[model samples]
Target: MGIKSALSRPLAAYVVHRDRQWQREPVAAQLRLLRRLAATGAPTAFGRAHDLGALRTPADLARLVPVRDYEGLKPYFDRTQAGEADVLWPGRPLYLAKTSGTTSGTKYIPITRASIGNHINGARDALLHYVHATGRSRFLDGKLMFLSGSPVLEQHHGLATGRLSGIANHHVPAYLRRNQLPSYAANIIEDWEAKLDRIVEETLPEDLTLISGIPPWVQMYFDKLLQLTGRPIKDIFPNLNLFVYGGVNFAPYRAKLFESIGRPIDSIELFPASEGFLAFQDEPGNPGLLLLLNSGIFFEFVPAERFFEANPPRLTIADVELDRQYAVVLTSNAGLWGYSLGDTVRFVGLAPPRVVVTGRLKHFLSAFGEHVIGEEVEGALREAMTQFPAVEVVELTVAPRVSADPGQPSRHEWLVEFARPPADAAAFAGALDGALRRRNTYYDDLRRGNILVPLLLTPLPAGAFQRHMKRLGKLGGQNKVPRLSNDRALAEGLVENP
Candidate 1:
């Protein structure tokens, strides 16, 4: 056996136990998680106020703590940030992860020691799952380039605060850190453009086996590497066998990323957020990510269609039905109590409980009463891209455009920046529109009614969104272009860029 495989036996063993229990008694696992949380967090003000100590069942816990968003929990989070002890978790957070959003601005998410450990353990379990499925550990002996944010964190009242990737980078095991790409000095560069430049310089010659990052940013790196080496990534890094990605749907970039790499390699999808490590893709063939029921995060699901309703019903893992969309509400060891992560997901597997992240709850275009989600839009775009074999969509976003004149009907406006421009941009947009109409009945009805005008497609100049993000100081890390927006500000801003 390989040394890495031998050392990972315990983790592999835990995966076996966890997967068996997940398949057999997922509900029991969730109950045990809640009970454990009640014990650990019982002393905190949030726990005491919610009567978490006395809670003996999931139903009891749910009834006591109302589902809350970041704004709802901001007060307690503020106190915790101000050095208060046990305001939410057992004590003060080990660090704060700054999660940036267009609507909510920046949110400081607490990360306790236990929560950080769970994040690390989740990453380990992801690899262990891969090893178990494929019986391959040769990649373990080679280097891993984590194309993440700057690791040098800023101090906030004696507590480190930075991006989630940066926070996790601080806790990366020394053994793996030895193989992680980009020198410490290169990684600490705050400017993403500068960091990418330095990363290319430092790791271009390394024998990298694994690469992990958000898809768009990694695409940028791949493009840049191709520009520098005049060779495909597979040729440059011959041993590069695995690609781990998250923070956006990989569908649109699948073809483009493959083209840049010049070949297919193993890929894993992770559904991690600053709030918690939620799920990760377990099966190579299956696109669905397996929810981590025992990973220090208690989950509740509120149907996405009814999320805005007053007192929307929150269902636990045991009650979630397959193929139904739900907004994820999580109570984690990270001090977030009954917090809604704002991401929507649909369960594909009930036995072991697997889910596919659909979209963000707030990030939908429903101006004309035809609600179009990120998943639907992305899927439509992917289908359309299949027709234009030569074109590659680099970045895109959509917003509603209500006519200024009274007689005009409203329509959807798409701003797309392509790496390889389509021969016929109008034809491409038409295909995308037709695909959306087929996928969303509401959208199709509105179009057929002439209440909404034909979808308008505007080809944005390359790097437009990247430039906008850079201006917003959100050019990299977990920050991504919001796929769908109600307001035209973000899309228009990118369009307005000369």
Candidate 2:
């Protein structure tokens, strides 16, 4: 075996330091991390309530609170919706980081003092770790454009308003508050059409070298940038580095975005989320996901079988074996005790556990009684896209709907934006159609004969993606584009006309 990665262990140790000393402690010695978080204020109250039940081993947390989903937090949510002071966070409640679920309701996850501390530490830790792993300090090379939720803050307009992008930024650490191109309050709730226009006109820095946010939204930004410059984006920001993104899957758009900028996925990095900055693509050569501050939050792994069942055994950090898909659960300084963020992960190893996010247990297409997951969809899309040479997919989304025809079948539909515009839409559509049917059984039957039509290829306007960013008010900076929509309302609204 190779001796060691030059920068990984030291970077891992730094990440561990952020989690109140628990993150760095060995898996077998994190009881101290638990005790430290529990002794603090605000967290101490809720932590006591969860009891977190003696985390001597991964199996121990199972004895405390079982893995929980948002549906399980109805009481806390109700308290929050009612403006109860003691709803989620026990202290003065530093702030709220609002994230939306697949369905309608907004989840105002409490970001306490510890959570804020961890967020800042992790954000910086990720930077430091990236440098260590790559021996590069491109962090300040170019301004990072974040395509995110609205930056505007509206007071009590409605509960769902909490999911706006601007409100979520409230919890971002003070240190990072300035590097942003525009204040998030400018993105949140407003006339998106106008905000995007101003954002497009004002922000697009000449020195921009890095772009961050979700894939779809960044694609939109590239579209807008092209409209403004009338030249290749690669020509505009010649030094643009990587696209740091999260919130949804990125495989589908990898081809499209790269074709636009004439680059590849290595220029981008995926991230960890609310549960913790769980893992990141550390070293390009390694092709492995690096676990962050492992000692900070104790990790537990339950076989896929136990994810939805009543009594799943929680495997400790030391107990995790490589290459196994597990339902993720965590105990952290953020005051989340034995909380199941409702996501799945795959481990590449045990010690320091290199891992990759697999899929979200909650977000899947169950409308057809067929359980299709994020990974399956990503796999099929990549497999289909591989059919063409020099083709990059800019926009790809899946939806479930019944057509108006008498014998119509339930189907998966996609809208692809390509770098080299296809000469024949019908031929291009047919090739992708044949590939999907062959790759997936349920889908194959859906397209057998007259059931579901082959996948539809929508040719976007020259600056089509930009119109989307302008519409969403994510002209520049860590904003994201919507990846999958079951309903066509939003997609139709986003459709481009040349």
Candidate 3:
């Protein structure tokens, strides 16, 4: 057996064992593990505050610990950052992952040694599961390029702090490190353009088989590679066979990204965050990711519709029903207890418990009593973009255009930065408006009643969104354009960019 196949044998076996274990006593298995976590964490200030020591069951734990957002938990985080030991977890964390979430301006997610181990293990399991399902291990013989943030972490309160990708870069397994592209020095450069240029310089000739990154940035690299080499990706790297991505929905970019590849390649999705490694696509033909139950995180769900309730009902692994949207909550080894991740997902299955990310809880447009979410907007845009095949969307956002005059009805405003500008902007906007009306009943009703006017489309100058992101200090890697903002904050910000 080759090196990767040999290593994956045992790992795949473990994954299979865990899968079976989860299937045969899903609730009991999860509860048993959660109790152990609570017991271990009982000595911490947060645990004691919630009386975690006395909690013996999932129900008991849920009843005692109220769900909290990052703002609510900031006091505890402040304590930890001030060098207090055993505040949330067992000891002082080695680093804090800095993330700029759409809702939360800036969050410092604690990263413990134990939690980082889970992150690393979860990522490996995802690949191993891919190997097991596809019966393809030879690709592992070639290099794997991870398009990630810089490896250089900034120190905060004597502890390292950086993007989750940057923090993860520090923990690349020794075995995989040899197969990973770009030298250590080159990977640590902070400027994204500079780092990408260095990566291209270092990896162009390497035998890259697997590529992993958020879809947009990866797409950028592919565009640059094709521009520089004057050859399709398949011609540049014949060994390329896998594209693993997450952080943004791949539906809109799937066609464009695949076209760049110029050949069929398998793709996998991951649901990872700075707080924890949540889920990964395990089975190839499956629609949803396997909900990782035993992976160092105790999972909970609050109904999406009731997410903002003063004390919404928090459901455990056993209580979740298929086809219902829920806000994801977690108490993980990372020291975050009863914390809402601000993400909404729907359960597609219950037997093995699989889920698909729906959208962000805070990311919805409800300007005129018509609640349109990220999924709807993106789906509409993707459907409309099909008609204009020549137009490639680099970035886009939508906001309500409230009319100043009573006679003029409100409309939706779209600020789109296109890589391949459309042949006719007015026609493109009409197609998009039609698509949205067709997909969403509320939007259709509004349009039919003349409650809303035809949507406004502004084709932004190239790099407008990038310049806006740079100004906000959220330039690259995991930070994406908010598809449906309730207000014009994002739209105005991008429009103001020169």
Candidate 4:
């Protein structure tokens, strides 16, 4: 074994042991974290406004600080961007993580010195856990590439500002820098296509063992590599084994990815966002991601069904129940107070508190009162893929298709880009519809009442989704197409262009 791999084994064991000790007492750890965040925020402008000094418990925080999304907290963010210190957190923020906003034009989330470790070490610990679990530290000696945004930072009021991934690029530990791929120049290339080509060239000859990125982008890299070399990914880089991914459900892309690689390999899932590194898969074959209890972020969950109520109950980790969907709220050391993260999640295991991200709060389709969430759609697709093993989906999105004609019934329209189209398309659609109905009672009711017809499947040529994203100037770098929309905006665009 190489020196780095040999050394990593002991470190991995130590980290795993330390991690499990805290995981054993999740509720206590979370309560302690909440108190720390409250105390730390007591000196900030927001803290003073919310009377954070008197807060001693989760109930106290919920009473004092209202849950707010980006627009609701824009005033404080504006102050921070204009060089104000201690507006949100104590003193000045070390960096600003720039991210795309839907209603707001651009969002700059603060990354304080105390909070940045949550982002960096969360990823490090994920790999360390894998090493400890499987004794597979040899991958450390090979090229490890993180498909991410440019590391180039643009200064905003003297604070280094860039995409979260770009900000993370600066914090990659020195030990693994030697094994990192795509060179500095390649990573800095502005255009994604150009950068991808450069990455392909730079790593083509290297001993690539692990790759980490959002699933779709990583699939793009795999496809490009195959196009250039005409070899299965396993043959191109024999050492390549682990694929670490986040941002979207991997079920839709799993079949295609493994097909490209020409073999099944291990993968690790992470639930990370600009706001915080929330969770990571701690065990092989376990679908749930172990929620980070001591990561300087205190989590709250509001029942998704009651999230829009005037005063929804915000429950702490100790109060949440298994299998119930809840919208995630954050109060972190990064100075975000009761920040609505917009993602919905369900706890699969609560002893140590493991969750699966279900969908975004605003990303569901309820145009016709049949509330179809991202998890349902993705789950439905997985069922169809299972039943129709010949089908290979590249990308897919669902939107409501309302009919103007009184005689015509409304239906959900699925726009799918297929690498391999299903031979029995009708049967495949039936399987998807059946699976969705089984999962969602409202949808099943609508179908039985003839309020909506079976979903319509519209196939698009390969690269259609990629082209559409490029047209919207969201070609790469943390952009994802919504799995379901209440309106026909995304669906119409795809159909018009295709």
What TM-score goes with each of the models?
Answer: 0.96, 0.75, 0.94, 0.99
Q: Could you tell me which residue pairs clash in candidate 1?
A: none
- What is the per-residue lDDT of model 4 for residues 183-227, given as tens digits with 9 covering 90 to 100? 999999988899999999999999999999988999999999999
Between candidates 2 and 4, the one scoring higher on TM-score is 4
Q: Model 3 scores what on Cα lDDT?
A: 0.85
Candidate 4, superposed: residue stretches over 4 Å from native: none
Model 2 stretches with alpha carbons more than 4 Å out = 1-26, 29-32, 35-56, 80-90, 102-104, 138-142, 150-179, 183-189, 262-268, 272-276, 285-287, 294-296, 366-370, 400-411, 415-498
Give the better candidate number (1 or 3) by lDDT. 1
Clashes of 4: 0
Q: Global lDDT for candidate 1? A: 0.86
Please give the TM-score that candidate 1 achieves against the real structure: 0.96
Q: Per-residue CA lDDT of candidate 3, range 1-498, in tens?
A: 568757776778777777677668888888887888899899999888889899888788778888888988999999999999999999999799998744557789998987887788878889888887887877777899888888788888988999888888888887778898878888787777787888888989899999999888898799889989998899999989999888788877777788888987998899998889888888886869887888788999999889887888889888999888899999988888889998889899888889988788888888997888787788888888889888788778899999878787799998887777779989999999999988778989999998898899988997787788888766667777787888888888877764
Q: On lDDT, who's better, 2 or 4?
A: 4
- Winning model by TM-score: 4
Query: CA shift at 208, candidate 1, in angstroms?
Result: 1.1
lDDT of 4 at 6: 94
- Model 2, position 425: C-alpha lDDT score: 66
Give one clash count per candidate, in the order shown.
0, 36, 0, 0
**For residues 1-498, what per-residue lDDT tens digits would candidate 1 score against the true structure?**
556657766667678667776668889889888889888888889888988889888788778988888989888987887878989988788988887754567888889988997787777778888877877767877788898888778888778999888888877777777777877899899889999999999888798989999899999899889989899999999989898998899988888898999998899999989888899888887988989888889899999999889888889987899988899999888988889899999899987899999999989999888889999999899888888888888889999998868687688998888889889888998999999999899999999988887799988887888889999888977788889988888977887773
Q: Which candidate is the best by lDDT?
A: 4
